[model samples]
Target: MPRPRRQTGFAQVTPNLGEHLDREDLLAALRAPDARVENTTLSGLELAEVSADGTGFSNVAFRGCTFEWVDLSGCTFSDVLFSGCRFVRCEMGRSWLNHVDFHSCSAPGLSFAKGRFTGVSFEDCQLSYVDLSEATVDRLAASETNLMEATLHQTRLRHVSLDRCDLTRATFFRTSLEGIDLSSCEIAGIRVSSDLRELRGAIIDEGQAAELIGLLGVRIKEDE
Candidate 1:
């Protein structure tokens, strides 16, 4: 038997500043009712065990921040940069990350279902178990990133460049992967389409070779 997933704690938490102070000193601030942060630079801060919902964060630089077991549902972030940040068991359903750059971040079990991202760059990031199902994005570039076990069902990926990314065990049900390169990627257990041969320019390795040969009407037998 496995434990069921619990809702993030930030849903019931909020940031409270006991004394009037700047955003840096506000790290010690208690949880607020809504936890709305604006125009704040919370760089290199460790935010743990907080579940946030409907929180609006804009123009924030969250470099090297550690967020664990956090939920950011319906939150809107713009011009935000998360460099060297780590997110563990984070839930960000329906959140909007417009023009946000997540550089050098490693996140596992990060859910962003039905979210919208525009002009976002996921450079050198590890995105495992990150669900982007039915999500919409524009100009999203993921360079030197790993997307192992990531779900991208029915997601719109236009003008998205996944250069040098690892896509092992990634799911792409009913998704269009035209004009995308996967040659520098690992696609073991990847869910693709019949026209995935068009992505031969992007996929690399023996597994893809075998699959592509099979798609090309070539048969390989144990005894030739």
Candidate 2:
């Protein structure tokens, strides 16, 4: 299969959403054997512990919604936009997201292992303890996001850029980060999980280099 095209830049998303729902019918959808909600707009609702595994969401807009411990594994989201949504410990592993935009969303402890993201942008989101291990990402832009304790093992990050994202305690094993710049991101205690050779051609600032100095087998000494 041919490689997906790289993203040049993200376009501003302006959704002319349909229906203004104060409360989502999401609870009813979850009770079904397999829920698939399409072309809906959900906002300002709390989806607590709902399960939508293997569900499909198309042309959906979720704004200011809070998903608490929701099981959304194996779900497919296409043309979905989430702004200011809070996802706490939500399970979304192996989900496929196409043309999804998550602006200012907080998704702590969310698992998206082996998920495929195409034309996705996660701007100003909080993604702590998130798992993207063995995932395939094409054209993903994550700017000003917090990715603390996240793991991206053997993941393919093609045309991905993470600007000013906090990567504290994050692990990158067998992941190619070449041509990616980490000058403005926080990498405190970030584990390579492999040899430092994977970071070749990656850009980092002087401060970040100082932190990784020990990894290069260079010892810091007191000034004489």
Error of 1 at 30 (Å): 9.8
Q: Total backbone clashes of model 1?
A: 14
Clashes of 2: 0
Candidate-wise lDDT, in order:
0.71, 0.81
Q: How close is candidate 1 to the true structure, as a TM-score?
A: 0.75
Clashes within 3 Å, all models in order: 14, 0
Candidate 1 local lDDT, residue 68: 83
Candidate with the greatest TM-score versus the true structure? 2
Off by over 4 Å in 2: 1-14, 20-25, 31-35, 222-224
lDDT of 1 by residue, 137-193 (tens): 777877778899999988988877676678877888777777676665777667666
lDDT of 1: 0.71
Candidate 2: RMSD to truth: 5.5
